[model samples]
Target: MLTISAWKRFLIWVVIATGLIFALPNGFYTRVERHNDALAEIEQLGATPARQEAVAAWPNWMPATLVNLGLDLRGGAHLLAEVNVTEVYADRLDGMWPEVRDALRDARDQVGTIRRIESDPDVLALRISQPENMARALEIVRALAQPVVTLTGAGARDIVVAGENDVITVRLTEQEQAATDDRTMKQSVEIIRRRVDEVGTREPTIQRQGADRILIQVPGIGSAGELKELIGTTAQLTFHPVVGRTADAAQRPGARQVIYPSIDEPGVFYIMEQTPVVTGEELVDAQPSFDQNGRPAVSFRFNPSGARKFGDYTAENIGSPFAIVLDEEVISAPVIQSHIPGGSGIITGQFGVEESTNLAVLLRAGALPAGMTFLEERTIGPELGQDSINAGRIASIVAFSGVLVFMALSYGLFGIFANIALILNVGLLFGLLSMIGATLTLPGIAGIVLTIGMAVDANVLVFERIREELKTARGPARAIELGYEKALSAIVDANITTFIISVILFTLGSGPVRGFSITLGLGIMTSVFTAIFVTRLFVVMWFERRRPKTIEV
Candidate 1:
């Protein structure tokens, strides 16, 4: 009865061996992590001698991954930002002005001449020459409205058109606002993630907090200010046709054009068309490079649609100056020297090497849908993180040693087998963590130490069951089999209940709490496996080899 088939024995040993193999790299975590990073860099930049040597520092055949340390463990910057979703509403309304003008122009005889009027920042207002024809104008503009595609939007339109007196007002409807908010938040999170990843930090957490706020935690970043500076620039790059150059800052160039001062020259200003031919959203790639004058600059390539539009505009507007605007400021106004057919161009400005590189990174990450205001920011130092790690390490070692000694003293040789299984259980836990690239925090360490005590509970239950069965009229093999059989129900019930709790914590909790839940949940699984399968296989092998007639409890 206390026997295992050949296949079962192989499976049991294979699991142990696999766990050991994966767990081995964690013992040399720093070396393995550096090796992995070096290999990645080499692959990206083409294999170089130095990088090849760095990769050789750790063998290629070995497991290269290590459990990522969390912000609490590694020390980093934390920021809570609120996105200005309302600003996007204003921009969306402003963008529709051109289309509204063209649509109303078609029925000029009925709607009369339309002139833009200053109104609320979030509303588009237009004054019609003929007061009685305001309804006709509103009807033409409302035809441009599209249904909001969000679940909450239902049948509502994206824009609401209303006419009062001679003024036609356009504003984003409630449904559209809800949809915009969702898109803005998702875009903000994604852009923030891209910006952070560009700096090559490991495992940064960028998540949405409420409806309009974002929580960013980037490990290994020195300060919150640094993190803010990296992602703060809206980086809204656009190419607009230059209407004319102006020296006066106060000069208003109608509603269709804007006046912006030159970055290189303080006194000079450029009046550029508000509507851009192509925006950075269409850019496929951007990189830092040097211009003809050896000045730091950024070169960008547009996507196919953008390229065709850009090429057509440049070919038609040869010899006309075009403004390269960055965040509403004019970077440069370069005249088209020839019929530029390619979608690629260079942005030349007063930039240092670092500034040019930063610009390239921001452009590549894409623009945030809306601006963000930092509500809270803080930085955790590496010293504090190191102290936490040291404390956790000491605690784990103490708990593990005490448990090992107690189990050995309590059950003699049988207890030693449990101890062996316990060590393997921990090894298996780390193996899974590393393989999955889970982040481990201080709370996670507590979870591991807690697991050590619980790991032995299963063995204790079976050992007690065997002692009870020995008192009955039964041989060693029959008693052992019955012991395992009786303990199985209690083991399953206890572990399953605990595993369910871990799942709940993981689902509901954030950050550190989730980390704790992960280790605790993983511990529950590994402990059960080593306890029932690994420990029993050891006992079965020993019993079969010795042909024991009797055994002491």
Candidate 2:
């Protein structure tokens, strides 16, 4: 408010300073361990121009190495898997021997106790009779750890173990393969995260949603379909039938492999391989290369134990057909012509660079426990993402300039104050995004554009009010005071409602939508501060110099 010009000046300067720090981007002002790692990797590869530029820029000018982009702007993929919570419950119950023992004891006594025990979304112990078996039931309940199966007994008496039972209760009661508690679901999310990392989409965002669902965002993904194919398949490796291949076939199917249904890609080739004369699961690492036949192949070497296993398998399976299937496709079905017992082997197939790299990553990680399916599919091509980013940047500059010219032209000399505030408002928005590490998507850029207009509008509101007060012949300071007091409520009310909507969007939306909401919301706050405090500070300095009774609006 004009009531405290000195305080306003201090606050505006502070906001501007803080925003500058944030706007610089992490590592821009300082180099760290991350810069070294990237440089090392680039140098080791004998950096191409692009890679060299990335290293030269280091923490500044370069995009953040770990900077996570929203799925839309960066062009990535999302995959959701249905976790097998049934196995988890079974395993947990197996481990909960003491509690199970106590519950069974109560039931055996024919007293009021846990009658039936079934575990589905959440672990449960059903109450049987009453008073008689109550002692054993109490004992069973006592034996459970606090984080153990959320006790939902079918009796009149109950207790809340935690503040929110919603996270641990039998909310969706019927799915055996599903998990309902925070612990199990969180565990599943962690596992999925590990699995996605192995898939080798760098800096992917994997998090849990609700109790059972997982949210995964993989940025800079080239093939959304392929990622869906790779991640959606649980890659649950097992020995199975590929009856199509005969050891003495007239011609081999490129390499000896069988096709099964892919869990990730429906109707796609799944590897029907149980008979691994050698398994990559045993391989410590794999590198891609072209074989002697000029065909793309992956070269892998096994550990000592794996070497022994491979040597034995090949020796035993001599003259038998061994297949190598991946994600259900029979890439090769090479026959064991003889006992070629080496710890190292090559997988030659229809391999492009990405396909080989992805397969190598997956094989290096070991198999998953179950199949997975995609709940949603989204694709953002590289060309399109770049175009959008360019458009957004151009639009922001244009919109901002337009706001500046309009404010200055309409308000005359005072509009200069509005322009200065508007520019600071932008810097503050960038600073906030950098500090908070919020992703910036194309939609978020639009939010920034909108914020520029709003910042100018807030200044206009204040200036108009000041001009009106000046009409009553108030002194310069008094006119400014009246202006701020009147405009404060309208500015706060309008921005607060918008902020609430932004909060809702952030809370309910996923991936890019959340990014947009965060940027938009930050923009609103920054705009309000810049316009109210910053512009008012400029007005104070102006009034002190000119002592004008009326200001142009």
Candidate 3:
């Protein structure tokens, strides 16, 4: 009953030793983190003496991963923003105007001449020259409708077209609006995450809250305002053909053009076509660099189609000015000196080095689908997080010491075996956490303490079962075998039930609740393995080595 194969013994020790090796790095977490960060920087920006020194501080062969601290344990910013999904509805209508015009012009003989009329931004109104052909006009516009492809809006039209007298009104169908909202939220989350990651934060949480909201929490950030500035920029970069320069702000060139003030020159405005020759959507990469005049600038490259369009426009419009607009402000309107065949160009303005880098980051991350209004903001201080870490440390020490003493006093030598297993179990837990890069928070520390108390329950049950068998006149070895055999069911049932509870908590909870669930769940698995397997191995080794004819459990 106490026998163990050499292979199994080797495998068990291998796992324990591997876990200890991985957990060792956490003892020097600050140094390891610095080393890792230095390595990443070197990879990104090339090697420097300081970075090389930092990388050399920690060996590459050693485990470099550390447990990521959660927002509660690290100073950071938190924000809850509501994405304005309704804004996309107006944009959708504006984009459909060209298509609608083309469709009506194709059927002009049947519907007569069509003229766009003023209405709400979310609604398209067109006046038909022929009033009697209203039904025919409706039929022609309705043919442009497409089915909404979503679970909630399946089989529903994307647009609804209606006509009364000589006027026709167009609006997005309810189902299409719902689908658009979902897509907008998803795009917003991704863009926000990309923007946050570009700054090289350790771990940022960018997630959707509901139908039209997003929750962002980034550890190690200074304040909510800083985070808002990082992801809040619409960064709608567009290159438009400059019609002319004018001092009059009231001058209206055409319905399809607008005027914007110059960034460098005050009191001067440039009237440019509303339709952009190229937009940031086609940009594949952007980086901060210096212009010919040694000033800070952002260099960008466009995709194939964007490059082709840009080349054609530049070749045809040489010696003409085109304005580079960002957030409705013209950065600079420069004349095309030559035909640039490649998709690459430089954007220059009165920008500092930091501004140039930030612009590059934004261009690389792409633009937000729609604007967001922050509903809540918070900035957690590092002092509070330090206090929390200190408190958690003291609590863990107290709980661990108490558990060790109680076990030793209760079961003597056998209890010492359980204590040793318990120590290794904690090591294994940290090992797994580091390997997975799990985030640890205050509640996660509590989960570890709870695990310490529960880890010995199976041992206690087994020891009690052995004592009962001894009273029945069984031999020590036989009593031990029967003890482990009979206690297996109870141990499995109890741990399985607790594991299920952990799963349910993880599923329903967020933030700190989730951190606690991760540790609790991981601790359960490690404790069961150490208690049943490692402790049993120790007990069997003691029994076989001593060959005790009569002994205590």
Q: Report the lDDT tens digits of candidate 1 across residue range 327-402.
A: 8889989998887777999988988998999999999999877888999999999998899999999999999999
How well does each candidate superpose onto the true structure, as a TM-score?
0.95, 0.58, 0.94
| Clashing residue pairs, backbone N/CA/C < 3 A, model 3 | none
In model 3, where is the ten-residue run with the lowest total lDDT?
249-258
Task: Report lDDT per candidate.
Answer: 0.90, 0.62, 0.90
Worst 10 contiguous positions by lDDT, candidate 1: 42-51
Residue-level lDDT tens digits of model 3 in 1-553:
6687889888989989888888888889888888998999988889999999989989999988888887888889999999999989987887688788999899898889988887887898989898898898888889999999898887899999988889999999999999999999998999999999988897787788878999999999999999999999998788999998998878777766789999988888999877688888899999999999999999999999889989999999999999999988999899999998888999999999999999999989998879999999999998888998999989988989999999899989999999999999999999999988899999999999899889999999999998998889988999988888899999999999999999999999887788899999999999888988899899999999998988775
Model 2: per-residue Cα lDDT at residue 27: 32
Better of 1 and 2 by lDDT: 1
Best by TM-score: 1
Q: Over 4 Å off in model 1, which ranges? A: 46-50, 247-256, 292-296, 338-342
Can you rank all candidates by lDDT, best first?
3, 1, 2
Instruction: Point out where model 3 deviates above 4 Å.
Output: 248-256, 275-277, 308-320, 336-343
